[model samples]
Target: MTITTAPAGVSLRGVGRAFGDHVVLRDIDLDIAPGEVVALLGASGCGKSTLLRMVGGLDTATSGTVRVDGHDVTGIDPRCAVVFQEPRLLPWRTLAGNVALGLPRDLPRNQRDSESRQWLGEVELQGFADHRPRQVSGGMAQRTALARALARKPGVLLLDEPFAALDALTRLRMQDLVEDVQRRSGTTVILVTHDVDEALKLADRVVLLGGAPTGVSVVLDVPGDRPRDHHQPELAALRSELLAGLGVPRRTPLERETHAR
Candidate 1:
């Protein structure tokens, strides 16, 4: 049987979320097109993750609506899959077994196993399928986590700082892997990340969330071909702009020279 892809668009209107006395997000409005990759960029405690959770139906808004493909989602939407910062794999389960957990219950055990193994291969963890989560390296474990999310063929993939815990090299590798997979699958993705460079490198549009009762402070369109170079002048300029938007101070040339000395 051929697997069908279902990439859904997301819409949020006048959305607000509060925890008791404190409000995290307020009057936020955003729209994401099907197959578009959007990064929610912000500093820590800026409510980017909260906004993403609302889109995924994992959290309810105190005010306004969250829609997926024109339908309002109330609880955990089957159309969405989330990969968090930590791998969060069950230690006792093999990598393939964890991936199989994402498959539909209607699928036969044999088919689930086959599909799980296929997804493992897609994430370059086919050889580790039989290995328990404890047996794999951190990067390998996160790869397995990503495969688990993709195996379900979710219409929308939500990533909450999925690479924040990885080393620099491994993080770059995982970012490349995600770009390749999303390009092939054309799944709509909302990635919540504090890393400005990571957001600019991966997203078609980068939305900055900041300020008290945080909402979008800036929305930048990143127009270019795939596999963007971090050292490119355009990206570097955008990076500086993003950092400034997030209240980061940019050092002057003289200050840089002094610091170097």
Candidate 2:
């Protein structure tokens, strides 16, 4: 199967989204270069996912424009793929079948099957291709969901908290898997996640969304290499800063002393 080597760049120009009188996003301008991994961090209901949906062409912006690879996204772009929190796999289909759903309909059936298996293998699920979604563990189902997305060889991947439903350890493992796949495929990615540490671990830059009619409140460049150490002082410091930005309270030294008294 051929992979798309050139990832797509994304541009959001004065983007805004509203449902009737309720505004979700407002005048948000952002750019993501080809093959760059960016994480959108925010509390629930802050419109981070809405922003990602506009970029994916799954939802429209009420104002401004969203472009991928220089072309405006008026609808679902064939070059993009999206994975949501739930695996959303078909109960009746086998894992291979689910992954094959992402392939082009014009492709030969055999070729589509071949590509599906290849992607499953990429996500470390080669042996489970025949298993139904119900037969696999949650992590495995999510992996298959990821394989389904990657099989399309998308130029841009939009993930809406893909691992958010998993347990802590499983989520960490999924994060590593995604990072590895993104590194190998060079796909531009926009990940919307509420977890600060997850963003720091997976993203080259973390963009924070906050306030009413949410816009990017902070853009942080994560220092260091791939597979960042969560316990590293730099990451911890950055995590603390992000948590504070997300309204997670941190006791000051004086407060800590007072509490101890």
Candidate 3:
């Protein structure tokens, strides 16, 4: 496992999104340092996915800017890759085939094969190279999906609850695999998760997205230490803090208007 450090610094300025009359996000301002993993935490309908989409260039913000490592990604850039909740692999393709998809066909055959094999091994799926997506277990399939993302060696990785569909034990193993891989590769990661423990275990900073328009509700910095054990006392405390933040009651629009007056 060659631990290649990733450039993770990110800045968002006046970022917002809306669908017709529905404003899902409003005036989001955040800065994530290089090599940092920031967890976007929120309840369902809080626009966490919308925010991540804007960052990943899958969806454009209705307004404002999203910059990764100082470059705006209003469109997909070769510098970043996204791994969605489902494995989303082609049933006809083998594991190596899926990863090889990340490379340009313009590259020579030998080079592509080498790159694909290296990335698959990096993701700990070396033995499953010839298996089709359906032939592998859920965890193994996800490993291939992850390998596909990393084969390109992107500066940033966007994960949208990639392990949500797995069973509890598989999810835990995937979580550990992610931590180990990210630590070794140093890829800047932005994860959208509803699980507090998941966020606490992996994020350098956790930004809670809430409010009717989905404003940044709270930003909690996990303070224990690098590669912090998820079972540690301080990390557990931080998870409690996040849960408490989520439990904060939201006031009605009329109440907010009244208070403003």
Please estimate how well model 1 matches the true structure, expressed as its whole-model Cα lDDT.
0.89
Encode model 3's per-residue lDDT on 1-261: one tens digit a residue: 364846667789999998999988999999988778999999987989888888878899988999988989868767777888999998998889899987665879888877788888987888888889999899888888888888767688888989989999999888888888888888898999998888888898999988889899899898766566777856655666677778744444455679999
Task: List the candidates' TM-scores in order.
Answer: 0.94, 0.94, 0.90
Model 1 ranges off by over 4 Å: 1-4, 251-261
Ranking by TM-score: 2, 1, 3
Best by lDDT: 2
lDDT of 1 by residue, 41-139 (tens): 998998888888888788999999999999998999889989989999999899999998888889987898889999899999879889999999999
Clashing pairs in 1: none
Q: lDDT for model 3, on a 0 to 1 scale?
A: 0.84
Error of 3 at 52 (Å): 1.2
- Of 2 and 3, the candidate ranking higher by TM-score: 2
- Give the per-residue lDDT digits (tens) of candidate 2, residues 1-261: 445557999999999999999998999999999999999999998999889888888899999999999999999988799999999999999999999998888989888788889889988999999999999999999999999888878999999999999998999889999988999889999999998888998999999999997988999999998888766667766787798999996654555678999
TM-score of 2: 0.94
The local lDDT score (0 to 100) that residue 1 gets in candidate 3 is 39
- Cα deviation of 7, candidate 2, in Å: 0.7
The 10 consecutive residues of candidate 3 with the worst lDDT sum are 248-257
Candidate achieving higher lDDT, 2 or 3: 2
